[model samples]
Target: MNERLLLDHLLVRGPASRADLAKITGLSKPTVSAALAGMEDSGLVHLAGEVLGRPGPVTSLYDVTAGAAHIGAVDIGRDWIRVAVADLRGRFVGRKDGRNAAKNSEDLVSRVRELAQAAAGQAGLPWTSVITAVVGSPGVYDKDADRMIFAPNLPGWEGSGLGDRLRTALGVDVTIENDINLAALGEHAYGAGHGIANFALVSIGTGVGMGIVVNGELYVGARGAAGEVSFLPAPEPVPADDDTLRHGLTESLAAAPGVVRAARAAGLHLDTAKEVFTAAAEGDPAALEVVHAEGRRIGGLIVAVASVLDPELVVLTGGVGHNLALLGDAITSRFAELGPLRPRVVASTLGDSGVLLGAVARALSQAWDHIFDLRQSGVQPRQSGVQYGMSR
Candidate 1:
């Protein structure tokens, strides 16, 4: 109990001397010293440095041994795959990014494995040395079915045994979560949503999705699909087709592809949403019109979210949604036309790293829990061969 308490304090508050730990934890100096000594021997805490030039004897500052264990974070997207290796302190020591030109889900899994190994190698460690890994992808993971669902953007992603393949490919215990949900967590931890108790992250790019944070906690619905807002009906008419049904009305009409489709219809010879946004930035009338229409669609979506969630802020992210400067006016206009409710909206500052950072944060939590569990059971975590989330 003493060691765990001291370690927890160190992890949360950074390095501390014995006297400081004792005073903060309400324990005697001797007790604090004993706990520090025990944790130091177990390779969980270390004397990081010494406070010099003090009025009395030198004070030894102790901290959690951040490099004692490592965790992996993977962000799997339609166009890219990102992997990061982070220490116990949630600091990325190594990272690798690669284009995701996967022809199928199996190829995607293999690509993720390659990137994971490369990232681990950059940190001077083998991939197997990572204790836990969290994978952020486009859809909610169905635990009972052991597959992903509602991820039409990524072809073959909803197939059966997808989770098993990821675990096998990575050779580690993996936790799969919705990428947008992770982005919300990332913003809360390190971006625009920081210090906000309640907010929502709505991503509009290849697909549209929302992640809800209520009372500073991620709120996934009963089926882990709390913020799947893409299925919401749009104000404009939607064609009844297989593609439209697969991606839902709102997504089909508001996402990047929708922006491109609208641009093409407006006589703008743009192939990608990026090109349309670029053209709009360069003062192209046709492109600007398309962007404004897309923004209005997003505005309606935000109004819907605000009616139900009433979040403190809504963070806009993803390839297309991050263009807040271009979309702000139209979004505000549509908000006024829709209703009297006005929700705070901001662009995500974390950019492409939001999901990856959130994955690292979650993996760190899991690593800490697993390490302490082993310690409580009288097993040295460094010597324990059991992987995280696995039965001993």
Candidate 2:
């Protein structure tokens, strides 16, 4: 499996020298040399360049050849569908991001097809060339039913045959996952959570959710509802309407609309959450008060999560959570007053690309697994989606 291991590492981290690969995989010099020779003979890898300005001997770097295979990743949000296509070597081919106007399951399927095809076209590959596709959506995915649940923010998504429709439309193996969970994976692999053993990412956006990573792996509980933090009881009074109940309690208090409500109650004429943050930056008392309250609510949620899981880091993200400059000091003060051993809170550096990048990471994982399995079994790898059921 040395060649398999080398290829996988290169696909993830890009090109590297034999010494670097050996160091990363803990393989010896002779073992790495043999594996590289075999991979080069098989036409899977080629010499990219040589590193200069090193201490001693010059090192030759190898990269995976392009057009070996393709993977598609999609981020399906309430208002947009972002699509990206990458090759087996982890090189991006194309991307398409557009408004989501789907009102129901059928419309959703059509929109996904259109976006995926356009992305593949831009990448100079046919849509049929895509081998595997992973979709990051906003809900707890019930794999048994193959539909989304507890996703009130996405109207008409619950109980719909969205998953099967996507599979049929895309004509590839499809896997559905919670968007926030994907964001956590994105952050862990490429952003703030890198190198942290245990951490929690709390996203405050159109809705509130948490994604927990423990011991360098995503910890989705039985029935895939581990990080559904929005249902936690609200700390303050909320709208108390049927719609608000459908949306969770904590979410109604900490998400974007919650900020607007706090502003209006304080007699501020702000129209959106961004405006409120802007007003606060300008030193408006009413807006600053709302900002402080929102920070406290977020800080309380962080404390609650820390008390149970005790993660080392807490990454704040999403539409409301990413305003770190405004909320950072307030959240820190709230936690400091409470007690010791509180997790350090930080903002997401990945920004809007978190979900989509995570989808790509997951898709490449599955694709590589299938390729390795084919090599082991002496069977040719096909474009069909390899069947595997993973916890969301």
Model 2 regions more than 4 Å off:
9-38, 49-61, 89-91, 379-392
CA RMSD for every model?
Answer: 1.9, 4.3
Candidate-wise lDDT, in order: 0.90, 0.85
Candidate 2 root-mean-square deviation in Å: 4.3
lDDT of candidate 2 over 1-392, digit per residue (tens):
89888887887788899999999999998999998986675556889999999899888999886566788899888778899898875566999999988887687778889999999999888877787899998889998777899888666788657788889999888999999999999888889999998999999987899999999999989988898998898988777888888788899989998899889999998888989999999999989999999998998889899999999999999889999899987888888887875788899998788898878878888987866666575542332333221111
**Candidate 1 structure quality by residue, lDDT tens digits, 168-208:** 99888899999999999899888998899999999998899
Which runs of model 1 end up more than 4 angstroms from their true locations?
381-392
Give the TM-score comparing model 1 with the true structure, all chains together: 0.96
Best model number under lDDT: 1
Q: Which candidate leads the pack in TM-score? A: 1
Model 1, CA-based lDDT: 0.90
